[model samples]
Target: MDNRKTPIASFYANLQVFKGYAEKEYLPYTTSAGDVAALDAALDNILEEGIETVFARHDRIASAVRGSAQAYGLELFLDSDRSNTVTAIRIPEEIGALRLQDHLSENYNLLVATSLAQYADVILRIGHMGENAFIDKLIYVLSIIDNGLRDLGFAGNGDLAQLFIDIYKENI
Candidate 1:
């Protein structure tokens, strides 16, 4: 009754296939055609836009998000060298992360991430990636966050959307 030889274990096994692929010697099975087609389409889009351009866009959007958070008097989880895909902000103790998240989603039709484990309800994450990494989209999200915070009794220091536009324009 060895687990290694069990049908369930076999179904999940991939080490052999991985080793073969790594050696450039074998393909254990055919890849899903739908997945391949989707990947091809995604790669085509990236090539059409240029990889560097995409990276630059992500950088610009992330920078703007960080700057907007700062302008709103929100503290970033990481003070320096933050990611170019997402920005995590400390939720005001008085306002609470879930309150803000729900406010945005219910009122503005926007969704934001809350930190996990010990940081849950302490931090909120805003992601700016791929199609979401655009000035217009970020502006809308920032505005919603700004309003949501105010609605939850947090007095922001400045307009988040305006700050994002200013920062994004400077980056561009």
Candidate 2:
């Protein structure tokens, strides 16, 4: 409820897990002489699994929102008892390290309808890197913020939330 205090601890905790995974499994395979062929195969597997995990997580949260919406109606939107909604964009194979790096600058968004679907009342997320150095780290934290605030309806300061919602609506 303390929106004034950013979720730094939560962000760091998720970031560490993401960093460890990259250091242990992702980095060596990509940069070192540790079996490039095997590493490439593993990377392929990770990507497939990662994409699946992202969507599954989002679906789960969305479902919760729908349930709450049915029970609580529009009041569900302002409730604090819900989990956060997080939607991950599909990562294309063509996106290299540099593109992944730049993606860090873009804000991620998920619509209120997603939360309304499950009656979840809240949304949350974790982001893993694409292909660049510490890219996953940045994504992990940003996702936390994106989904955290989205659930809380605190995505932006003042009218920023309305502005973002408008943009999101236009794009969709």
Candidate 3:
């Protein structure tokens, strides 16, 4: 049997060739020039801000999000292995994930992700990554979530936006 002729092996070989081309500033396929320009701009911004500072900002934003979730008496899906970019929160049974997501979208023009499969109705995912990892943007998102939950009859223990701001300030 020629193992190298297998589909997986062929795919790997093609991937290697593509990588080699990329290393030499060549593309064997068509790519969106606008996307490449946008990526270049993003890279330039990150370089100007310093990668470490960008990482620290993400960390601070994540901490604030988690703290605000705790203050709202919401349970985190992953207690320890949580991500620095997205936070998975277990929504209250009465709230309904779709309801919360729709409320935010319809009322505030904000979109939040709902979990998949069996957990879809119970989990809400909030992303605080890249450009979304800023304090002002996070505060607005938290406020919208707080208002949406309140409108939906979920009584949170503390003000979500205020708690997020407090936690963010503490981290800074």
Candidate 4:
């Protein structure tokens, strides 16, 4: 995800896999053994042929989109807060992408917290727990400080991103 080229293709790849099962088995939601087998076969095809085709198509699509974005000197960014320092760039399509990224990040944290909280034994075994640590504590902390600074209208100088690392090394 840190990669400049986001895993949008991964979504497409997974969609192809799901599409196969949806096409074969859920032909009306009435379950049948034969239908199940057909679904399995279709899924296998997706694993074999459909995946490759879909992946390639998505790769091209992403390349095209990124290239276009670059062509205009546009950039995609996530502002820490709606009002404050303007992190705006020329990137036009990025507005939607940033919203989706933030939404997904929030959803992923909630899912992790929910699952971890449900497993009490696991939680007890690890005394250090919270949304911060459960779902990428380092990234969470750094992003928070980073976002906080940005939200305060202070542009990053790349120092805040290294605070946690320095603290870790000092304690070690």
Model 4: which ten-residue window has the lowest total lDDT?
121-130
TM-scores, all models, native as reference: 0.80, 0.19, 0.87, 0.21
lDDT of 1 by residue, 134-155 (tens): 8888888888888898888888
How many clashes in each candidate? 0, 22, 0, 0
Model 3, 3: alpha-carbon shift in Å? Answer: 14
Can you tell me which runs of candidate 2 are displaced by over 4 Å? 1-49, 75-172
**Tens-place lDDT digits, model 2, residues 21-86:** 754665422345566776887679668768766545444434432332232212223334433342
For every candidate structure, what is the RMSD over all alpha carbons to the true structure, in angstroms? Answer: 5.9, 18.7, 3.9, 19.6
Please identify which of the two predictions, 1 or 3, would achieve the higher TM-score against the true structure.
3
lDDT of 3 by residue, 105-154 (tens): 99889999998899999899999998888888888888999999999998
Question: RMSD to the native, candidate 2?
Answer: 18.7
TM-score (C-alpha) between model 2 and the true structure = 0.19
